[model samples]
Target: MVHEYQKDDESSVNSADEALFEMLGILPSLAIGNGVPDEEDDENSMNDKGGAQALSLDRFVQRKDDNWIRKVLANSDNINLRRQYETTSVCVFPEALRIPAIEMRRLADELVWGGHIYPSDKTYETLRISKDGSIEERRALTRIENFVNYHSGWNALCNDYLRRLVSLALGQPMVLYKEKLNLKPPGGSGFAPHLDTPSLRVALGDRGPREFCTVMVAIDNMTTRNGCLRIAKGVWSEDHHVNTVQPKAEGNPDADGRAGAVLPELVDQLQFEDLVCVGGTIVAFNGWAPHRSKTNLSSFARRAVFLTYTLAAEGDFHDAYYQEMEHLRNKWRDKVGLPTQISNDELMELNALSTVPRT
Candidate 1:
């Protein structure tokens, strides 16, 4: 049911403008061309700071004016975007955001350190124990969810620009359903082969939208050694609808696979492509894409922000989706004789007990 991004009619244009102005009124600081400098200017400014600029949320806000929208629309090749999505169910844009190197480092530090410094009910961070020959429980962070709600810079990048990019690819307006910051520190564990649609369905139930897309913006260089994402090649065909049914809960001992992951037998039959990317690269894929990553054997950390969206017409479910997921997570914790309340220290203990080291 997706189509090209045709110019809206006069009434539609008026409505969109009204919505934009209303949003601007509520978030005056986010107004287009507000004191924030352009990406090029920001890159130049980093030179004065010895290429080690302090992290500031203002640097992340790109100009979201009508002119910016027009430029984005003009640059996008809708035909090719559609063709790739239809054929492979995935698309990649290398260095699309063009964030400065200092900015990237600053952002990563903010995400990693903020969770430890200020632990709150709003923060959702998960830790993991290293599997590499060390008997000590190496507390490495694995993921942080709903960060956009706190960091204005992330909100601008994820909720505005990235969301618009996916909307262009899908040829329809989309809204944010959820966001997560995934961190794969050295010797971190990888996810088992699975489709996001099934997990999303389990969380949202019948209220979920029929179509969904996830956009990943790489904050660090992703490589084979660093556990880059690997996706099945063209597994989402009309003849086989992988989005409707949930995979079996049987775990894979060798791969350290989790419940609701695709069986190893089926995964072995499909061809997969490793999505190696440099910092600022963006990868978008449909909900049904079977994807996973490997352990981070490399010395560095692999960080990326994953933003999931559904059609705007379906309605915004950002808060509600997180609520349901938290409930399910709490239930699982209770069953394991763990506390429902999560804190910085509790996260470490939880992962220590729950995470199975990958062989």
Candidate 2:
């Protein structure tokens, strides 16, 4: 679980990512996956396109065929989601995304391995020495960020479906802050208990809305053996947890360090519950929630997409956040003498390779 927001205008967005923004009323006049018709088309063609766009908007409002989103929204209200969020800082909706787990997994695979969504430079992998002294690699935790920029389907999921749910929980109109595709392969590493606020503060210092919420849509069945998320009980906001920003040596030892990691002593005091969910489950939590996961001990991969949002009134930081992170990552890579870019072939190979030994 992690939390990370803002509204964007047409002028502020690029062509690729503008569709959803426009539909959200953050901009105007563009339907996702269906752009404006060309001038070369006949009058009838333009009229048909216009009708389709209108129908899309109608469907979005009525949620005609997308009952899963509607059901999740209804359930959110049924559970007194706002109160639960205020008290626990987290909530879960099982199979909320509506799509079958297999279909979700397929979409994830295509986004990662299809080689069209994410650019070569945006793909990365982590390497470690095995017990047998062999070099093994796993896809990096933040495999793809701001994926909504590339694929229309993902764009809708984040800006349309998940965004509406977050807005409901937060009791305000929310906008996209950032989104990521997290892939944890069999034997892949897990994150340490940490609050996302510190890292977000570092990336978006005084930018806009500081408050944030995250929605994680499970793409595969998440279980203890497969590195399911474990969130601590309590609202660990800056005011509630004064020492949240203090780095502890026991935190993430990887490139991210311990910036947001909680003190081990404090973590020991909190009651943690493992969130085991079937694929398509939606887990939403505030940025202040402290959460972590363990390495996958099972023989399958654990995959999920995390989308973060902030109050729309705070101004959009989506583009800025991604740009800053990219810059920092590239700088760090350069300092370490590693290639800053990855090739499509290499990305595919990395996906094919496994840290897990075959039985």
* Model 2 TM-score, 2 decimals: 0.68
* True-structure Cα RMSD, model 2: 14.8
Error of 1 at 348 (Å): 5.6
Residues forming the 10-long window of minimal summed lDDT in candidate 2: 350-359
Per-candidate TM equals 0.70, 0.68
After superposing candidate 1, which stretches have Cα over 4 Å from the reference?
1-61, 64-79, 94-97, 116-136, 235-239, 242-260, 332-337, 343-359
Superposed Cα deviation of residue 172, candidate 1 (Å): 0.8
* Candidate 1 pairs with clashing backbones: none
Query: Across residues 44-80, which tens digit of lDDT does each residue of candidate 1 receive?
Result: 2344245564334354444444356546545665536
Per-residue lDDT tens digits of candidate 2, residues 174-213? 9999777777654556776777776665555786568888
Off by over 4 Å in 2: 1-77, 94-99, 120-142, 245-257, 331-359
The Cα local distance difference test for each model comes to 0.58, 0.58
Query: Candidate 2 at 162: error in angstroms?
Result: 1.0
